[model samples]
Each structure stands twice: as C-alpha cells, then as structure tokens.
Target: MSPRQYEDDDAESLPDSRFLLPQLRDADTEDVEKYQRGGLHPVHLGDIYDGRYRVVHKLGAGGFSTVWLARDDTEHRWVALKIVVADYSTSVSTKSQLSCHAASRCASDAVFGFVLERRHFTLDGPNGRYLCLVLPVLGPSASDLSKGIYSRITPSLSRRASYQATRSLADLHAQGLCHGDVTTANILFGLLNIDRYTESDVYRLFGAPETAPLETESGETPGPEAPKYIVKSLNFLSSIESVISQDVRLIDFHQSFLISLPPEQMLGTPAEFLAPEVAVGLKASPASDVWALRCSIFRVRSGEGPFSGFEVTSPVDLLRIVIQTLGEMPSSWGDTLFDYYGQPTKEPTKGSPLEPVVETGRVRLEDRVWKEDKKKPYPPCLSDTIRKPTATKINNSYIDGYSYETDELLEALPKISENEAALLYDLLSKIFVYDAQKRPSAREVLSHPWFHMGEL
Candidate 1:
C-alpha cells in the first residue's frame, strides 16, 4: 500500500503528539535586540501567518533560520516554512545569500537537478521582519539516514544517489555556482506521507471564499471544525524498502556562492570533508564541491571519512593524511604560505588577519614518494628533494619527522570487488587531485565508468 494510504487510515488511531515540538530557547541579549528591531517573533502550533499558512510543527533549526511544517491554506497542502532570523536578513551578505537561493530555484526544474525551491513572500513581524521561504516538505536528511542505516547502503543505492547528486552539482556548476557546504546534512530523501490530511478536507476548511464548496459523496459541506492531524514519531526511512529506486535532493542554499564573484567567506565543513585547495587557502570552485562530493560518497558507503579516525585529530594531521594518501602537493603550491584562514599571504606573520594558517609540517619532497619496492610506489622522482618545507610561524607547528603510508587511510574503507574498487579509487583520485585545476568537472566525473556499472 502507498505510504499516504497508511497515514490516512492510521492517523486517527495515532496519539496527538503534534505539540511535542521542543520549546524554542529564550533569545539571548543580542538576539532580543534583533527581534526588537523587527527580526522574528515566536511561533507556535495553530498560529496563522499572512492569513494563509497555519503552523503545524517545527521541522528543524539552523544557525540563522528555523523551519516549520506549515499547512498552506491557499494550496491546501503541507509546506516547509523557513524564516531567516530577523537580524541576519538585515546584513548585506545575507541578501546576497538569498539571491543565490533564488537563483537555485530556477535550476531546480532542470532534469536530474534537485534544489529545494522557495516560494514568493516576505512575512512581516512586529519587532523584526523575516524573509519567508516556502518549500516542499521533504523527509530526513542524508546524515540522519546515514547514522540510522549505517553501512547498509548498497552499491546500487550509492550509484543512484551519487548520480543524482552529481547531476545536481553539474547543473549548479554550469551556472557558475557552488554549494559552499555540501555535507550529508544538506542532502535529504524525497519521501511520501509528509502531510496527513486529504486535499478535499483541506479545501473544505481553507478553500477560497469565492470558490464552490468542497463536494462530498453525500453532497454536503463538512462541519466547520475538523480534527487536527497529530505529528507522531515517524520512522519513515526505516520503513522504506531497501531498493535502489529512491532519489535524494539537495537543500540549504544559505552558504551557496557564485564562483565568478570574489569569495566573501571561508566555507565548507571541518577537517575530514574539506577540500585540499580549501585547506590550503584557495577560493572555492566547482572542483571544491566535487571534492566534498567524493568525501560524502565515501562517508555514506564507509560510515566515516578518510581522515576521521586518527588518534591525532588536528588540521595538520588532516593535511598530513591528504599528502600521504593523495601524494605531494604541487612543488610550487606546496611551499606557498597561507594565512590561518587558508588565504595566500606573502609571509606567515602572527595576527596577520589570517584565521589560522595551515601547518605545513617540515615536508621533504623525497619522503612524499614511496620506494619502488613499496606498495603504491611513487614515480621515478622520489629522490628529488633539496630543502624542508618552510612551516608557517603560527600557533600550530607541524611535526618535522612525521610520515604516513597511503594504506593507513585506505585500511578502513569497505571491501568491494577488485574492478569496482579500482574504478572507485581512480574516480576519487581524479577529483581529489592536489591541484584544483586538474580536478575533473562534475559533468566529466558523471561520465566516468564507475557510475555505469550495469545497475545504472
């Protein structure tokens, strides 16, 4: 049976737990001042907005916005209502972010592209106004699913999800855009049974005043009051059959940026998922997104990132792992000193507006390559080194004698077929190239043989 059918038949028997939305924490002094400046107002179940959307429950919250599962009386369906905290919308950067989001909506209709589109409307509050974005209610995020499902995701499922994600990224890249943050949390499943009520009932209660009354089998308008649908603890992901047919969608464009413009901020997730170029103070590009995408694919399949489980968990260690696993950084690029925030600088001076310069431990070019006898041996130039890599004089210092083998990082990877494993490794290496210029574009990666492994 369809998920919606099950929801319709069982909704009445389910306990009314819609009010279980966790109470919003009290706003801090700064947030209070922002709200006083017309930022946002408290929302609760049953609260009406713009005389149309009725709040049903909270969906989730982020650093700058809160999403609620709201019923759009005009459309007579469920929609996700995202409200940017009032104060943030006032910032110039936030305006640019919203513009990027608006552009993403245009690409959502493209074949294979899956950006969460926003509806038109700016909701006004008494103290602080808000930029209201109405979107389709989607299921759990990829991160949530990954945690629950763990390593059970099959190769076919991985290929399909990755294929869709690549197409989405390629679409963005074609438009000179970059999803600055492409973590699993921003990817969600497109599931059913999100809303419990039938459209007929919704029309009867909130349909247009001038429209004809909603017709029933008995040819009569229902009572003015209808029982509200309750929000229950949904195990939707668990309920979904282990099939490779399902698709994923990309959401959250607040961090998206245009590649043609100068980057305004350092973006992307922490150590494990960050791109090599991003780690070494370079502007984000489509290739950076590719890097994150590769990391995400690995995490979804293996349950952890390449550099996640090390005893020494620091940015320096991450860099070390990258060098060991991916080979030496380009000679010229390797020696370049970046400010703490990964921005290139002439000199590594302390307190020099650099966030925290990457610690380029004393790397010797000779050490980067493995001997001919070693597994995964380096090229013939293994003996070509003259000087130690100059370390940035920042708070964090790199270890002089530190070294690693590529197998150290690959050991935790899941065991697959020899051909499948080789294809996967080759694809990852291409995207994770030390030089961003050499990294394959989303379209190029999409055309790789790994994705066409029969199941596709």
Candidate 2:
C-alpha cells in the first residue's frame, strides 16, 4: 500500500473515500512515533531523510502525507518532499479501517498520474509511497500577500495573479492535461527576487517540526499541522513590493484531472469552486478550469472567494449550490470584487470592510525587537499589524514564517476599477467557456487586451 495524502480540509477530501479514513486515535502515540519513526534522520539544524537532502523545513501536512523542504545533496538546492504514512492521522481511529490502504494507493496513482503529464502535482519517488516534489524555493503565495503580511496584495495584484494562473492553465490545456482542482491551496505564487531582503526577513516552515507545539506533551497539534513539516513564508521584505510581472508558475496537481475533460466531470473539487456541469457527473473541460480559475482570481482581488465562508453539511447540499450559482455564473459570486481601473468603479453601496481579512486563525502583528534591543524596531516596510511573536525568526522553534521578496512579483500599486476587473475576468473567461472549441489557447490569452494596453 502507498502512503495517505493529507487533505487541507474535509471538503478538500473526496466524500466517497475521505470520510472512511479516520483521524489518529491518539496524539501521544503519534508524537512518540515521530521520534521513533527513524526515517526522519535528524540533524542539528533539523531532521532529514538522507545525509544529502537535509530536511531544513516543512510546508504543510495532510491526512496521509507530510511535506518538507530538503536541500539537494548534490546541488545544494531547496526542494519540497511529501512523506508517506501508514494511515490517516492519529485522530481518526474510529473512521475508515480501509482508509490507510486506499489513501496510499490513491496517493501513488496521483503522483504518477501528474508527473507523467509534466503538470504540477506531488513529486514522485521509487519507494515508500511518498511523492516528493522539488519546487522552486520561490516566495510566499498571494494569500501571504493578501493578509497584508508582505507587499499589500491589492486588487491589481490579485487580477494579475489570476491572469498568470489562467495563462499557465491555457498552457496546460495545450499540453493535454487539465488541472482538475484549482484554489489558493493548490496554486503557489512565486515571489520575484526582490534583492532588498534577505532570508532572515521571511518566515520559514510555519508547520515544520522546528515549530512543534510547545504546550502539547505529545508534540503534535490537535488537528492538522501535526507531524508538522511545511515551509512557512515570512511577512516583511515586501513593503514596497510589486507583483511579479514576469513568468508566473502555477502549482499543486494532486487533484489535477489529466484527460481532455476536466476532472470536475467525474468527482468535482471542493463545492466552493466546482462548476455547474462538474456538480453533476459531467466531466470538466478546459472551460471548467476557466470558471474555477476566474473564481479564484476574483476572490484574490476582492479578498474573498465565491464560496469563501459558506459551509454545507452534506454533498447533496453542495451539489445544489454548485448547480444554482455556478450554472448561473452570477456577478453575485464576486461579492467584494471592486475595480481599480484608472478610475475607481462605484463602491458597492451595500458596504463591507475596505479590505476585510479572512482566515481568522490569525495572530495579531506587533513590533519586532531582535537582539533584545528595543532600538531595533521592526522594519518600516513591515506593517505594525504583523502576526504576533513578531520579529519572526528561523530559530529552532516549531513555528516558521517567510514573506516573498522576488522582483518578478512586485506590482506597482496602480489605481485599478470594476470595469478593469470585469474586463480582465471577461478576457480570461475565455478559458471557462463551456465549449473547449470556444476556449482561447495560451498563445491567444497572451495576446489579449489585458496584456495589451488598449486603453490604459
């Protein structure tokens, strides 16, 4: 059997198989096991798999696998690795007894499926059912940007990020593989090399072992982030930052559907992004990816997604939402969508936070005083609203965070508008047209007005 791949959330996991897999029964046993597991290969800096690939950090965790960043033995490069496990997390002993076997197999199939396609997904290996991907140690994702953690992720940045994602998707469709599932969780935005900052400025692995819960005797978190091991991003260095206008790379292919038809047709993605056809048994086509991509980009621009905070107790219920809203492609889906064309489109008279923040598991930001000197206040580029435990460090602690400082990602804070947002999405919407024949190819997307300054 292969190792289980962790789902970011229950909804991210498929209903048919995920629910069966229970959480780990005990945290204490799991904690002890992390030490006893032996494969970790600990180092003074941290743990490792082999002497060559030093496991400096982790990016995130899942039910069956834990991801990490290891230095390449030969090249001395940073890469991401997904460690396979025997079963679901220790929390679910009461759930699917078959979860372990099924998860392992599915994980293996997923890695192999995408690697063969040259699309983004888990990295593949020859043994232990773990899929370790060597990703470009780029900067933080837009979520990092939006949190006002780094360079403010404004509407323009969000729109541009969406454009890049679509451009990449267009390229993927050209390659005959379809990204079945698309979301902030699945997509990673690379920070252009902003030389103004250094490694100390960004967050390391937020969920890495180095940041293990201090209070938990078992040494693991109550829910996910257990077996903690994913690289965390820092939140400074981007104060004057701009969006990367250069080549933007997309990521996460674990749920990517490869056939000509998008995977949504078979088993759709989380209800939030699922298209109308996908909610039914209809397979998603390039157009399906287009719809989800638009929703994602729009969400980034507005600081919320189409189904940002909605919760559904049953699959049947989610299906209903998918059919009703997705089928309609209502403008309502983009709630906070404001346009900042040269002129600001009229604000929604209804009203909302100027830039509301989501993901409320937040720690407030405070001033940093490194080296025990109050004189060394936090950098001006960094907002006072930074996450607490401020003056974040790569110290041997359990929590790690970093911000993006890549030059490629810096976007000038231009006065952007609803017309522009609509125009941008409408242009990109070509990717979601129900008919694949109607979809614009990558070559075509690049030539569109969004990229071409027709009116500026």
Candidate 3:
C-alpha cells in the first residue's frame, strides 16, 4: 500500500509506467540472427553482466532495473533476466531505487530462486544486493495479448482462454509458488488448433447470434474447423489460442513471501491486486492468493485495464476499491459471475497519473484531472496526454503512484494465481490459523481449494 520503502528525504526519484518499461527490443547479436528480433534499443541498468546472463541486448528498462530477454548459453535456455543498476554516484534517489529492487529480488529469490538455481546461477553485481536472477523467457506480457498477437493458429479462440488460465493457476498451486502478475500478456498460450476436429463441432461451441459477421457464401453454421469460434470468444480482449496459452507458473517472487501468515493479513502485492490485508502489512495465505486471482479473472473477461478511470493511484485507495466493491474477499466466486468486477471503486484522485497531456476537440478524462478539476467531456484520443494508458504501463505506474490501479492491474493479470481462488478470503484464515506458527504449509494451499474450475 505504501510506496516502496524509501527515505523521506530521497523522494521524487520514482519512475512511472511511461518511464519504466522501455520499448521491447530484440538483442542485436549474431547468436540470434535466425530468430526474429523486435525493434528496440537496449537500455543498460546496474553493472551489466551477471555470470551466465551476459548483457546481450536489453528488452526493456524500468525503475528498479532493466529486463533483458537473454540466452542462458551456459544453461541452455532463454531467460528474462532483470538487472538492477542505478547511478547512485550522483543521485541518492537512484541508489534507493536500486536498493528497492535488491530487497524485492532477495525476498523473491529467497523463496523461488532455487526453483531454477541448479539450472542457473546467482552472481554478485557491483552493489551488494544488486544481483541478477533468471527465469524462463516469456513472450509479450498480457497487455500485448490484449492488444492482440499471442498466437498464429486459431483465427478465433476464447473458450480455451479460461480453461487454460484456470489450469495454469491450478499448476501454480501444485507448486508452492503463486504468480503474482496474472495479466493477459503474462498468460501465454501454447499452440491450440481447434479445427483438428470436424467443422460441425466448432458451431456448437461458438455460434453467437451476437457478433461475428457470417459470410453470405457459407450457407450452414460454421463447424469446429472454423476459427470463428475462437474469434467470437476473444470479445476484444483475447482469442482462444491466446487463452489456452494463459497457463501460469510461479515467476517474479519479488512480491511473493513464503507461504506463511494469516489469511486476511497478506501484504506486499500491488494496489490493484493487493488482498484486503496487504495494505496493513499482514501475512498472506492461500485464501489471499484466491482473492488476487478473482480480480485477475475479471481483467481477462474485460479487455480494458481494471477500473480504468479514477486517479486514486495509492495503495490505500486501491484496497478501498476492493473493500467497497466485493465486500470482504471471498473463498468462492462472488455471486458466480465467472468473475466479479464487484462495485464502484472510488473515483480517480486529482493527483492521479491520468492528468491531461494534450487535447483534441472536447476535454477528456485527462483534461478533468490535468487541470485539477472535473474533466470536460471529449472524444476518445484527445491527445497523447488524454490517451488511455496501456495495461502494463498502468500496472507498473500503479505502484509508483500508490494508486488504486494496483489492485485493478492485479485483477487484470492474464496469468493465474498460485493457490486455488476461493469464494471468500477467510477460507485461508480457517486453514492458516491466525497464530503465525499454525499457518498451513504452502503445499496444503493447493488441495484445500482445488475445484477444477478451469473446465469453465
């Protein structure tokens, strides 16, 4: 809920979404010529090389560090390595930023680093805590998938999206790890070809009287072989192929703590995704994981970022959104709406990031916020300043802004949460006694709430 730990005097050094993730660029090296390289320039962070994860090319740079999709030549696998290097020489704020990344990585690697340590290495960087940890390379994040481009097959594929995501979450539960970041781009799908069956089966899954434009030439309802079913399912957010790829595994232990703590007291998640307890600094448990997942599923359903409006970017406001909307976090689905957006969260604050940057015809949401008053109505795309934010950008900035979007971004994660998502958050409380010593083991979290809901 609070901004990352920083000295009060060293404020004003934090970065926002627009500034955090530099454009994704392929590392221009001779080793990867065969593979397609996305056009982007590498930005350096930290002291550079981390043993096996040599700084090949930078994918994107952020406040804590730069994320580079590098080849683990020694280990023989593609990896997304984060290097936290800030110029503390001149800027005390830069040093603080580097320290924050180190603490977070320490917290994360303390638990999950070993999951791949034998397969990888953890060497020291220039700074004491500043180190490089490696995890498998991921395709574009859920935000990219939302913008469309996670798959090549299945012209349309959505039924598989939920199933894939649920199954992935179930997999995470099997392990003690929970994927805190569960947005669309993070939910990468494997290859899925629904048309391997006959064409008739296709219509059975997706003959919507609602959207698809049936061609005049085709007389009968499209069959299983058709991609229409997949396309119909996307609903502008994702396609079936993309959904199937959304299976989640434990990654990014930065925010995740070892499986301990009371259910309601879980802390350290982003504002949008933070369980009710996280803001107050309580222990997190399986039930808290469920709460995070429920919000994520809703994000998948709606293509847009969770609660796009309202500038309440702080953690306090985000938890207010959760408490205000769906009552207390539940162990099961809220009223069984596949996912529940719940209720009206607080409106954006005047100090929020959506402050206007430019103008078109009428005033936009940015306009209202920019001038520090009610934004005048304006057509979409008022200007760069008034434009809507990208999910990952908002997700990244929510923490910097301490805005409600933290939880909103959490809700929109495309990956799956670690333990089984519950109808209520208290289920974790019952399983993990309030007394920290009696809290359930990370292993227990998986079976306690496993319902095989991915079939949905």
Tens digit of lDDT per residue, candidate 1, span 1-456? 344565687787764421222222221111222223444455546777778888765566565666666788987788888777766655524644554554555554653355454463666665456777777877666565442112134566667677778778787778767877787767776644545655443334323111112223343433322112212222223222221125787777666777787374566365567787676666788888888888877766544555654422333445667777777766655565544433445564521322232444443433443322222212222112111122211233322223354233233334578998899888887777787888888888888888888565
Residue 128 Cα positional deviation in candidate 2, in Å, after optimal superposition: 5.8
Model 1, backbone clash pairs (residues 3+ apart or across chains), number: 9
What candidate 2 gets wrong by more than 4 Å, as runs, is 1-45, 62-64, 84-129, 147-152, 192-210, 213-247, 260-268, 312-319, 322-418, 421-448, 451-456
TM-scores of the models, in the given order? 0.63, 0.52, 0.42
Which scores greater on lDDT, model 1 or model 3?
Answer: 1
Model 2, range 1-456, lDDT digits (tens) per residue?
A: 111222244346533321111132211112222322322211223554544556654454443445555566666545555444433222122212222222234333232212121112222222222333344554445454443322235444454565667666665665556666676555555544533333333233122233332233434442322233222322223334442432334555545554543432244366667654454334576666776776676556544465553453223334334434435333433332222211112355423212322322222223222223222333443332222222233233312122333212223223356667667667745654444467655446666665444311
Candidate 1 global lDDT: 0.56
How high is the CA lDDT of each candidate model?
0.56, 0.42, 0.35
Candidate 1 deviant stretches above 4 angstroms: 1-41, 90-112, 124-127, 148-151, 193-235, 238-245, 310-317, 333-415
Instruction: Report residue 79 deviation for candidate 2 (angstroms).
Output: 2.6
Return the top candidate by TM-score: 1
Better of 2 and 3 by TM-score: 2
Q: Output the worst ten-in-a-row residue range by lDDT, candidate 3.
A: 27-36
Give residue 69's error in model 1 in angstroms: 1.1
| Model 3 TM-score, all chains together | 0.42
